[model samples]
Target: MHEKIFEGFCISSFILNKKLKVALTYNLKPEEENSFEYAMVSPLSKNSTTYNDTFAEWDTIETVNSIKSALELFHNVIMIEANEDAYEKFKKERPDIVFNFAECAYGISREGQIPAMLDMLRIPYTGSDPLTMMTCLDKARTKEILSYYGVPTAKFITAENLADIENHNLEYPLFIKPVGEGSGKGIFNNSFIQNKTELQQRLQQCLQTYNQPCIIEEYLPGREFTVAILGNDSETEVLPIIEINFSQLPSGILPVYSFEAKWIYDTRQNPLDIFTCPANIESSLQEKIKGIALKTYKILRCKDWSRIDIRLDSKGEPNIIEVNPLPGVLPDPSDNSCFPKAARAAGLSYEEMINKVLIAAAKRHKLI
Candidate 1:
C-alpha cells in the first residue's frame, strides 16, 4: 500500500515537472559533549543553571536524515544547516526550493531567520513566511491576532517578571510557557499553576530560565485535539484530527502535554497510548474543530502546511491552543509525532506526506 502511494506521488511529480533542486534546511541538535555549548551561548539561556533541554526544539540527525531521504525520493536533496553560514550556503547553492524546519539557536525571532534569508534571496521555501513565522513563535502575539479576527482563543497575558503577572483579572489554575519556545521547551508538569503563589514562583523561574516573556492563559478543562492542515487558499485540506489522551499519562501528573509528556514519558522504547487519530467525536464537534483549525491556518497565512492544536473550552466549543507552523515529522511511527500520525490516519504514507508538502509549496510558487 505504501509502495503504491509513493509510486503515484512520483508519477504526479513527474507530470508537474522534473525533479526539483530541494534544500533541506534545519538545525541538527548538538552531540552530548557539545549540547551544553548551545545552552551557554544562547542569548535566551540567561540563568547560570545548565539546561540540558536547550536543544529540545531542534531536530535530531535521525529526523533530518529521514526528511532528506523522503525528499530524495522525488527531488535532488541537499542538507544545509540553518546556522551562521546558512546565508552563504544558500547564496552559493541556490536550490530551486527549500524544505525548512529550522528552530534556530538564538533570539526571539530565531524561527524566522532562515525564511527571512530565503525571502531576501528570492528563493521559494516550504511553510510560512518570515512575518507569520515570527508572529506565531510569540504565543501572545498569535493569540492577539486570533482574538482580533474573532477566532476563539484562550484569554491570556504576557509577563516578563513576577510583577508583570500580579494583579491580573485572570482566574487561578492558569497554564504558562515561554512566549517564544516550542517543542514543549520550558513546559512541564509544574507549568499548570493553581494559585497566586504558584503563578508567581513559576513565572519568576520561567523568566530567569528562559530569559523571555511567559504567556499565562486560563486553563481549558476539557479534551485536547491537534489538526493537521495542508494546501492553500480555497483548496486547503484538514487531515484527520488527533485527540490527546491525557488519561494515558502516568498517575499524579497534570493533564497538560508538557515537555515531560512529549519527550520524557513517551518514547520510542515504550510508546504511550496517548493519541487517538480520527478522534471518535460526534460529527458536529468534528466539524467545529475542523472549521476553527482551517480559519486559524488562513488567518495566520501559513503557506504549505501546519499543525494547529485545539482544546475545548468549558462550553465544549473548540478553541485554538497553539499553532505550529513548522510541525514536527519524526519518521518512525513508534516515535508518535502528531503530523505524521495524522497523515497516516488519512491514508498517506510517510513519503507521501513529505512529498505532499513539497507539492503544495511548488504549486504555490508556480514552480511545478
Candidate 2:
C-alpha cells in the first residue's frame, strides 16, 4: 500500500508535522446517462437565461473521489459539494483548509463563486481569490492586465456587437473565442479566421452561441504551449511546460485546438496527442517561457497554482493567451488535462500533484 500510495510522492515534514481536517470542495457534474440528450431536448428559448449557463466546466465524480483520496493521504478529509448546501457542509466540517476545484454551475463569475463565499466564511482555500478568478475568467481582462504589466500578449479587441469589431486594426488571421469562457468553450475549427467573411461568421457564432461578447485577437501563428505554476511568491515554481503537438491529429485538423479537438475527437484509439511535455526547444527559449510565466503569475497575484496558456507571435516570442487559476485536474491518465500532464512530466504522480496544491495552499494560509 505504501509503495503504491507514495509512488509519485515523498514523505515530507509538511505531512508528518501535523494532520488537520481539510475540506475537498468540488462541483461534480451529474453523470446521468441521458445528460446530453436532456440538454438537446431542452427548449432554446432566447429569453431563457438558463441557455448556455451550465457548461462542461463541472468536475467528474471520479475526479472528486481521486482528490479526496489524495487529501486523505496526509490529513483528515471531508467532502463538500459546492452548491446551495455548501454552507451547511462547511459549518459541519469546519475544516482547517479548503482544497477548491468548484468551477461552479454557471455565469461569467462562475469560477469565483465558491472562493468568494469562502472569503465571507473566512476559510482559507487553494488557488486564486475571487477577484483573480473573475479577472482570469474574462480572457480580455486577463490580456489587458498582463499587457498593463508590459507582459507580451496577442493584440485583442472585444466585440459586444458586430459593430464593435468594425474598423478594427488587428491583423488578419485572427482568433475568435468567447470573451468569458474556459475549457475551449465556443472555440471551434472556425475559431481561426484568415479572411473577413470567416471572421464575421465565427464572431457571429460566438456571439449567438455564448450570448456574450467575443474577443478578436491577432492570432499567434506559431507554436502553442501551456505552463503550470505552483507555490507562492519566492517559492513559486514553473512545472515542465507542455507543448500542444498536433502532428498526430487527423489531417485537415485546424491549426488551432478547438472544443472539438479537446473533447470530441482524439478518443481512446488515437488518444489526444496534443500534449508533448518537456517540449523540444532551446534552453534559451525554455528560460524565456518560464520567466514570462512567473512574471505573469506575480502580476496577477495568483496563489497556490495556475496554468497559463501561451502561444508564439510571428516573431517567435511567447505571448500569454489565457491564465487559468482553476485548471482542470482530471484524474484519469487518458484525460488530456495539461496541469496534471505537466505535473506527471515533472516526475510527480497525479496524487502528489494534487497534494502539493493542498500543501501549498496550507502554507499560504500559515497552516502547519
Candidate 3:
C-alpha cells in the first residue's frame, strides 16, 4: 500500500545550492488578536474559548520553529509575526520570499490579510492569493462556487442572524459552522442541528459568540477523508488519501470530526486510532476521491498546494467539505495535522513536506 501511495512522490521541487532568504510569517497563539479588547478581556474572549477562538487557530511556537528549521536546510529563514509590527519588520528585513502561515487578527478578510500585505509589497509567498483565501474562509461562499462548477458539496444556507434562517424550511440534520472560521473552531458536537430548536439555539450561539453567521448545511453521514494536493496547478500530486475514524470518541459524542475531537480528544501522548492512511477503499473509489479533490483545487485556482476535505454523502459519492490552501502543518507527530499526516503516509518526512512547499513557491516565483 505504501509502495503504491509513494509511487511518484518527489521529496522536494528544487534542490537549490543558493540559499534564499525566506521570511516565515505566522500568527502565534499567545500573540493572536493582540488588541485593546484583548487587553481588557482575556485573549480567548468572553465567548466559548473553543468557538471563534483565534488562539486555537494560531500556530504554536513549536510549529514556527519546526518550519524554520526545515526551511533553513534549503534557505535562509527569518521568523516574523503577522501582527501590528509585522509591516515594519518585514519592510526592514525584506526577504526574497515569504512562507506565510498567518491567519490574521480579525475581520471577514482576516485569512487574506497577510497575503494582501505581501501583494502590496510585491513579495511572493506560498499558498492561494487574497481572493482565494477570503473566498475559502467563508464556507458558504466556497460551497456556492463549488456548486456553480458542478462540484458536489453539501447544500447549505448562510445566516447572518436567526432571522435569516426563519423564512425557509431548511433541511434537518444540518451541519452548523462559523461562516469564516477554520481549524475546527466554532465546531462542536451540537453543530449537527437535527431540529428547529437545535438550529435556533446553535445558530444564535454561533452569531453571539463568533460574531458571524452560521452555515446550516445537509449533514454528510458517510465516511470523512482529507486529501493533500502538492505542486503547481499543472503538476500537482495528490498525496495518500486519509480516512478519519470517529469511533474512538467517547460514547454519546457525534461521529463528526468536531473541535473537541481534534484538539481535546486526540492528544499526542495517546493519539486516537482515528485515521487510516491510504484509506482502505477500492481503486475506483480512490481515483474518484482524487479526481474530486483535484477538480476543487483547480476551480479555486489554488496556488502551490492545498489540503481538501472530502466526505461521502448518503448515495456513496464524494463531496467537498472545504479546501484549506494554508492547511495546518504542526510538526509534532502526535498533533493530528491532516496535511502532515497525509505527507507521512506517502513517505515524505515533515521536513520534506515543509521544503516541498517552499520549493514550489520558489519555482512559482522563478527564484530557483
Candidate 4:
C-alpha cells in the first residue's frame, strides 16, 4: 500500500516579513547554427510559417512579466536572464529565492541546465529540484518510474532511431511524441499513428525533428483531462480536474493536443474553445484522476507545484499521458491556460496563487 504521508524529509521555515529578495529567471535558447530560428521555434519552420508572439517567442520580458505578476505579493522580486553571467550576478546579489523558469538553453540538457547552476551556487529556487527535472525530461524514464510504482500509464516504448521501432511489440494506434520536451512541443494532429507505415513515417519525422529519442504509446482515444497539484510533498493539495473538449475540433485532426493547437495563432485551428475547468465528468472518474495525479506527484517527488495530463479510455478509466513540472501561468482570461484556471477554481486570486507557492516553500523552513 502507498504511504499516506510523505517521509524522509524535515520541514524548516525562514523568518516571516524579512524583506525577502526574490529573483525570477528565464532562458534564451542558444542560436542554432544550421537552423535559421531558435530551438523553440524550429518545429514551425517546417511548415514555412514564422511563429509570432508578444515577446518574440519565450523572451525574458514576457517571462519577467509573468514572474513579477506572480511574485509581487510576496516580497521584492527581481527578474534576471538565466545565464552563466546571471548566475554570477545572482550570487553577488544573493536573493532570498529564485523563481526558476529556464526550460533550456539550447538543444542540450535543457531542464537541468539552470537547476544545476542554482545547486552549484547553493541558491534556493521554486519548483522541482535538478534531479526531478532531469528525471522528468526523459518521458520514458518518468513513465518507467510510474509503472514501477504501479501507477496507471499507457503502454509505451522509447526509441532513439528508426531501427529501435522495429524490435518493439507496441500496440496499434500509438501516440508519438518527443521523449524530452514540454508544452506540447512536437505533438501535432498526425502524431497519432494507426499502422506500421504511418508509424515509420512519424517516427522518421520525430527522429529528424528532435534529434532525440521518441516515446510511442498506445493511444487512448477518449476524454482528455489535466489535474494540477500544489503544496509540498507531505501536504500536497489536488486542484480541480480540467478537460479538453475535442467535440468542436475539425474531423481528421487527432484529438491529441498539438503544437499548432497550443501555440499557433489561428483561432479556428486552435483548440482553446475545448478546455473546461472542473471537468464535467462523473464524480468517480474525477476522484480517480485526482488519486492518480497525487500518486504520480509523490512517486516523481514533484514539490511546490505540478500538472499531470490524463486521458480517459473507453471504459472511462484515467491513464497518465504526461507530467508537467513547470506549467505556464498566463492569467489572461481569454488564454485558457490550465495552471491559473486550476488556481482560480481552488479559490486563489492571481496574486494569491503566486504568493502561495512562496509561502509553501518558506513555511517548509518556518519562514512564513
Stretches of candidate 2 off by over 4 Å are 1-18, 32-54
lDDT of 3 by residue, 81-105 (tens): 8888887887788888999989977
Residue-level lDDT of model 4, residues 131-220, one tens digit each, is 788788788999999999998788999888788888778778888988987776778778889899998998898888777889999889
Question: Which lDDT tens digits does candidate 2 get at residues 1-368?
Answer: 75465654345425546787888888766644446323312334756422332456776667788999887877898888888888777866778888998887667888898888889889999999999999999999999999888999999999988788779999988889889887767776778889888888778877877889998998898998899998887879899988988776678778666766776665434576678898998999899999999998889889999999888999999999999999988877787778888988888888889888887887778774
- The per-model lDDT (C-alpha) reads 0.87, 0.81, 0.82, 0.73
Q: Using lDDT as the measure, which candidate wins?
A: 1
Tens digit of lDDT per residue, candidate 1, span 93-185? 999999998988899789899999999999999999999999999999999999999999989899987778768989877999999988888
TM-score of each: 0.93, 0.90, 0.90, 0.86
Q: What is the C-alpha RMSD of each candidate to the true structure, in Å?
A: 3.5, 3.8, 4.7, 6.7
Cα error, candidate 2, residue 242 (Å): 0.9
Model 1 regions more than 4 Å off: 1-3, 33-51
Candidates ranked by lDDT, best first? Answer: 1, 3, 2, 4
